[model samples]
Target: MTPEEITRTSTTYNLQSWSKQKGLNPIPVKGGEGIYFWDHSGKKYADMSSQLVNLNLGHGNRAIIDAIKDQAEKYCYISPSYGSEPRAELAKMLVELMPDNIGKVFFTNAGADANENAIKMARMYTGRYKVFSRYRSYHGSTFGAGNLTGEPRRYPLEPGIPGFVKFFDPYIYREPIEFASEEAASAYYVAKLREQVCYEGSDKVAAIVMETITGSNGIIIPPKGYLEGVRKICDDYGIMMICDEVMAGFGRTGKMFGFQNWNIKPDLVSFAKGVTCGYVQLGGVAVSKKIAAFFDDNVLSCGLTYSGHPLACAAGIACVKYYTEHKVLDNVNKVGKTLGEILEAMKKKHECVGDVRYIGLFAAVELVKNRKTKEPLVPYGKDPDGVMKGLVGKLAQKGFMTYSHENMILVAPPLIITEEQLREEMKKLDEVLGEVKA
Candidate 1:
C-alpha cells in the first residue's frame, strides 16, 4: 500500500529515520493481541522480532493493559525528584529480581537513557573518564549512549564524547584466526583486552561495557568462560564491570538476565524492554551499593522528567507478576530449546543458514552468501537483491511477520509464546526461505 493511500492519526509521532534507498513501507498497525498484529489492511502478522526486539511479553496482555490504565487513572506523570508508590515498589522489586549485591536501581525511559546514566554513574564513582565498549554492539541512539555504541550505526554520530573506546568482540563464526575452537577464540579475545588495558591504563578506565550476548550487529554469543574471564579481569583492574542486557535481559535468554548464563556478576547492568514486556517505556541500571552510595547528597547530575513514571512502573509490576505467576520464563526455556533444535535441523538443510546462535528465546539465524565461507548475505542495512532483502516482506506477504537486519534475522518472540505458535512461525519461515532458497 502507498503511504498517501492511507491516512490516520497515530497516538505518537513516527520517526522518519530510515534508509531512503530502501524506503520504509510504514504500515499502519490497528490491533495487536498475542504474537500477531493486525495492520489497517485487516491482515495479521507475527511479531517474530517483538517490535524492535522489545515486548518480551506479547500484545493484548490485558493484565498489563489494565495495570497501565488503572495507574494512569489513579496518577500519571510525577516529577522524578518526588517519591511515588509504583516507582518505589518497582525499584525494590527489580533489586530483588536482580542478582544479589545488585541492590540499587536508577530508572530511565529506555535502554539508551539507562546506559547514559550508567556511564555517568561509573565515571562519577570511579573518578575516571574512559569507558570501553566492544565493536558490533549498540547501547542506544542518544548522543552519549550512541557514542558508546561500537557498531557502524554509531558512525553518523561520531566524535561522541571523550574517553569512548571501541574494541573487538569475540565472534566465533568470523574469527580473526583461520579457525579456532570456542575456548581458544575466547582466550584470544581476553588476551586482546588485557593488552588493551595495559596500553590504555586500566586505572584510567571507569568500566568495560559489553553485551552478554551481542544483539543487533549479530547474535554473537560469547564463548563459555568469556564473560567470567572479563568479570575477573575487571575485578583485577578495579574497573567497573558493566553488562548491556538491553536485549538479553528479562527471560530473553530463559533467565531473568542473560549474564546469568555465564554465572558472572556485574557491577552494573542496564535493562529495559522486557522489564514491562513492552507495555510502557521503562529502562534502568541495576547499580551495586557502591555506586548507590554516590547518590547520598552528591547532587546526582542525572535524571529524566519521566524517570520512574508511575504508569510504566505499574506495567512493570504487572508484567513481573505475570512472569512469576504464569511461569512465562519456564515457557521460554521449553520453547527456546524446542526452537533451537528445529533451527539447527534447518541449518543442516539450508546452505544460506550459516550459523544459529541462541540463548533461550533470543535467537539469530545468520544468513550468508556461502555456508563454507560464512559471507554476510548483506552489508549491514544494504541489501540490493530481493533474496535476502525481501525476506521479512515475503514473510509478511505469507501471513507471518519477522525482522531481518544486516544479514541476520532475529526470531525473538515474547516469552509467553507457545511451542505450537512457534512452529507455525517456523513453518511459515521455511516456506518464505524457499522463495529465496539460494
Candidate 2:
C-alpha cells in the first residue's frame, strides 16, 4: 500500500493509543536500519527514544530477524505445558544475567503481563494484600498493571484494585528541601517510606514495586543508599521487593539490570522491552530462590496462553547473544558518557532546560519556563496548550524522533547506537531546544 493508503486505513479503522484520533497523522514507516527508520515518503528519522525505549537493538537486526524465521520453520505454536528448547535456553540466560538471588523465570507476552504476574506472585507468596509503587511510575496499562501504575494514565482505572498504594519518588531536583548530600536525601525519603509502611500496616504489604531507574517519568535516579534503604525496609517487614525493570533491563542502564547499579537484589524482577528488543514481544518475571522454592509445594497461580512462546523465546535467545557478542553494554557505557556530557552542555546552553538526568543511554531533559523558579514548561499532566507536543513535533521535523512526558523530553536511543550517531541525533535536540522561547 502507498503511504496515504496506509495512513487512511489506519486512521479510519484503527484507534491509536493515548491520543485524540481526529488529527492524528501516524508515520507510515516503510523500513528501518540501525538507529534510523524511514517513512513511505523516504524521510528518515533518528529513533532518539528507541521507539518507546524498546527497540534497543535498533531496527532491522539480521540476527533477530533470522532467528524468528528459523524458529518459525521449526514450528512456532506450542502449549506452555510442554518444554521448548528456545524457551529453556532463554530462561536459563535470563536467570544467569539476573542477580544471585534470582533463580527462576516465568515468561509472558509483554511488560504489562509480566508485571501482572509479578504482583500475583508477590501476593501469593507473602499472603499480603497491599503493594506500594511510586507516584511517578508507569508500570503498564492493563487492568492489574494499570493499578500498579501511579501516574495520571492510571486515572481511568480509578477506584482501582483494592490493595495498591502510592508514594512519592526521591526526586531531589524537585524536592523543596535542600539536603546536604545524596545520602541525607536518601535517609529522608527512606524514613518517610518506612513511616508510610507502618501506617499501611507493614505485615499487610505484599511488595514494594519500583522502576529501578524510574524510566520515562524523568529518569529519576535514586539518591545514594535509597535502594539499599528500601531493601532493608522490605527485609524488616518481610515484604517482597519488586523492581519493575521493564524499561531499564537488558543493558539500558550500563548494567544488566537497573538495580545492579545500586547493588541491590529485588525478590522479584519484572522485565521486558530490551530482552527481545521489540523484534518479538516478550517479558518475564525473575523470582528469587525462596519464591521459587515456595511454589514447590504450593500452587503457582499465574498462567498465560503465550507464556514462553517458542518464537519469542528464539528471538530472545538471539537478542541475548547479540548483546554479549557485540559488546552492547560497553557501547552503552561509552556512548552514554558522551550523551551525559552533551546533555549537561545542552542544559547549560539552553535557557529552557531546567535539569538533565541520565544513566547509561537513558535520559530526560526537563524543560522549564523559568529556571530560577523551576516552573515547568508545561504543568504536570496538564499540557492543555500542547506545548510539549509542539516541541516534540519540532524535533520530529528535524528528523529527531522521541517523546515527551509532562515537561521532560526523553533521549534514549538504541543500545547499538555509536557515539557519532548519538552526537548527530542530539544536535537536532540542541537546535530545537535553542528555538524554545522559555
Candidate 3:
C-alpha cells in the first residue's frame, strides 16, 4: 500500500497504544537496515531509542529473520507441555547467559507477563505477600506489571493489588539532601529502605523488585553500595531480590545484565526485549537454584498458553549467537563511550540540560527550566503544555527518533550501532538541544 493508504487504514481501523484514536497520522515504515529505518516516503530515521530500547540487534537482521523462517518451515506451534528443540535450546542458552545463581527459566510472551510470573513465583516461594518496587520504575503495563509499576502510568490501575508497595529511587540529582559522596547517599537510601521494610514487617514482604538500572524513569543509576545494601537486606530477611532487566538486559549496559554491573546476584531476574531483539516476542524469568528447588515438591502455579513458543525460541537462539559472533558487547562499550562523551558535551553546551546520566548505550538527558534549582522542563506527572512532547517532536523533525518521559529524553540506540553512525545521529540531538529555549 502507499504511505497515505497505510496511514489511513491504520488510523481508521487500528487503535494506537497510549494515545487518543483521532487525528492519528502514524508513519508508514517500509523497511529498515542497521541503525536506520525509512518511512514509505523514503525519509530515514535513526532509531535513537532503539524503538523502545528493544531492537538491540537493530533492523533487518538476516540471522534473526532466517532463524524465524527456518523454525516456521519445521513447525510453528507447540504446546509448552511437550519439549521442543528450539525451546529447549533457547532455554539452555538463556541459563548459560545468566548468572551462576540462576538455574531455571519460566518463559512468557513479553516483559509484562515475565514480571507477572516472577511476582507469583516470589510470593509462592517466600510464602509472603508484599512486593516492593521504586516510585521511579516502569515494569510493564499489564494489570500485575502495571501495579508493579510506580510511575504516573500506573495511576489507571489505582486501588491496585494490595501487596505491591512503592519506594523512592536514589535519584541524587533531584534529591534535596547534599551528600558528601555516592557512598553516603547509598547509605542514607539503603537505611531508609531497610527501615521501611521493618515498618511494613519484613517477614510479610515476599520480594524487593527493582529495575537494575531504572529504565525510562531517568536511567537513575544506583549509587555505590546501594544494590549491595539491598541484597544484604533481602538476605537478612528471607525476601527475594528480583531485578527487572526488561530494558537493560542483553549487553545494553555493556554487561550481560544490568545487575552484573553492580556485582549483585538477584534471586529472580525478569528479562525480555534484547533476547530476540523484537524479531519475535519472548520474555522469561530466570530463577535462582533455591527458587527452582522450592518447586520440586510444591506445584508451580504459573502458566501461559504461549510459554516457550518454538518460533520465538528459534529467533532467540539466533539473536544470542549473533551477539557473541559479532562482538556486540565490544561495540556497545566502544560506541557507548562515544555516546557518553557526546551527551556530556551536550549537557555543558545546552542551557536546558540539567543532568546527563548514562551507562553503556543507555542514557537520559534531563531538561530543566532552571539549572540552579533543577526545576524540570515540565512539572512532575503533568505535561499539560506538551513541553516535553514538543521537544521530542523537534528531535523527530531532525530525524533523531526517541521518546521523552517527564523532563528527561532517552538516548538509547541499537547495540549494533557503529561509532560513526552514533556520532552522526547524536549530532541531530545536539542541534535540537541547541534550539530548545531554557
Candidate 4:
C-alpha cells in the first residue's frame, strides 16, 4: 500500500489509544535509524522522547535485530513452562543487574502486565487488599493496572476496581508552600503519606506502588531521602514497596534502575520498555529475596500465555549486551550533562520555560504563562486553549518529535544518542519554545 493509503487504513480501521477519533492525523513512518525516524515524504524527525520513552537503544540497532531474527529461526514461541535458553539466560542476567535483594523475574508482554502481576503478588504475599499509588502516576491501561494508575487517564476507567487508593506526589516545583529545602519537602510529603497509610489502616494496605522517578506526568524525581523514607514506612508496616520502573528503568536516569539513585531496596520491581528497548514486547516483575522465598512454598497465582516469548527474551539479552558493550550508561551520563546545559540555556532564554528537571537524559521542561505566579502554559487536565499543543506542533513541523504532559515537555532521547545529535535536536526545541508566548 502507498503511504497515504496506509495512513487512511490505520485511522479508519484501527482504534488509536488515548486519542479522539475525529481529525486524527498521524505521520506515516517509513523507516528509522539511531535517534531519528523518517516519514514517507522523507522528513526526518529526531525521536527525543524515544517514541514513548521505550526505545532506549534507539531505532535499528543491528545487534537486537539480529537476535530477534535468530530467536525466531530457532523457535518463535515457547510455553512459559518450557525452558528456553533466551528466557533463562535473560532472567539470569536481569537478576545479576538488579540489586542483590531482587531474586526472580516473572515476564509479561509489557509494563502494564508487569504491574498487574506485581499487584497480584503484593496482595497475595501480604494478605492485604489496598494498593497505593501517586496521583500523578501512570501505571498502564489494562483494567487492573489502570486502577493502580493515579492519573486522569484512569477517569474513563472508573468507577474503577476496589481497593486502589491515590496520594500526592512530591512535585516540589508545584508545592503549595515554600519549603526550606528539598529535604524538608521530602519529610513533609512522606509524613503525609504515612498519615494517609495509617488512616487507611496500614495492615490492610498491600503495597505502595510508584514510578521511581515520575515519567510522563513530568520527570518528578523524588527528593533525596524521600524514597528511603517510603522504604522505611513499608518496612515498618510489612507493606511491600513496589517500584514501577516501566519508563525509568534501563539506564534512563544514568542508572540501571531509577530506584538505584536512592539508598533503598523495593520489595518488588515492575520493569518494561528498555528491557528489550522496544525491539520486542517484554516486561516483568522482579521479586525481592523475601518475596521469592515466600513464593517458593505459596502459589504465585499470576501469569500470561506469552509470558517469556523466545523472540522477546532474545531481544532483551541482546539489548542488555549492547547497553553494556556500547557503554550506553556512560553515554547517558556524558550526553545527559550536555542535555542539561542546553535545557538550562533554554530556560534562561525562554519566558515560557518555567522549571527544568533532569537527571541523565531523563528530563522535563515545565512551561508557564507567568513565571512569578507559575501559572502553567496549559492547566492540569484542561487544555482548552491549545497553547501547549500549538507549541508541540511547531516542534514536529521542525522535525523534533517529543511530547508534552500537562505543561511539561519530556526530553528523553535514546540512551545511545550522541552529544552532537542532542544539541542539534534541542536547538529545534529551543526554537519551538521561542514560539510560546509568555
lDDT of 1 by residue, 1-438 (tens): 333454322213344554553345567778899888887768888888888888878989999999999999988988987889999998998898888878788899999999999889988888898999988898999898899898777888976688888889888778748545777777888988988987898899999999888887778899977888888788898899999999998888888888888788899999988888778889999998877877785767887888898999999999888888888889999999999998898788787888888879888888887877777888655777755657877777876667777888778887888999999889887776655544
TM-score of each: 0.95, 0.99, 0.99, 0.99
Report how far off residue 57 is in candidate 2 (Å): 0.5
CA lDDT scores, all candidates in order? 0.84, 0.94, 0.93, 0.93
Number of clashing residue pairs, candidate 2 = 0
Model 1 weakest 10-residue run by lDDT: 3-12
* Residue range 1-438, candidate 2, lDDT tens digits: 889999999999999999889999899999999999999889999999999899999999999999999999998989999978999999999999888899999999999999999999999999999999999999999999999888899999999898799999999999999999999999999999999999999999999999999998999999999999999999999999999999999999999799999868999999999999998899999999999999999999999999999999999999999999999999999999999999999988999999999999999999999999999999888899999999999999999999999999999999999988888888889999999989
lDDT order, best first, reads: 2, 3, 4, 1
Taking all chains together, the TM-score of candidate 4 against the true structure is: 0.99
Please write out the lDDT profile of model 4 over residues 161-188, one tens digit for every residue.
8889999999999887899998999899
Off by over 4 Å in 1: 1-14, 21-23, 178-180
Q: Model 3, stretches more than 4 Å misplaced? A: none
Task: Predict model 1's lDDT versus the native.
Answer: 0.84
Per model, how many backbone clashes are there? 0, 0, 0, 0
Q: Which residue pairs show backbone clashes in model 4?
A: none
Q: Write the per-residue lDDT of candidate 3 for residues 175-258, one digit (tens) a residue.
A: 999999999999999999999999999999999999999999999999999999999999999999999999999999999799
Clashes of 1: 0
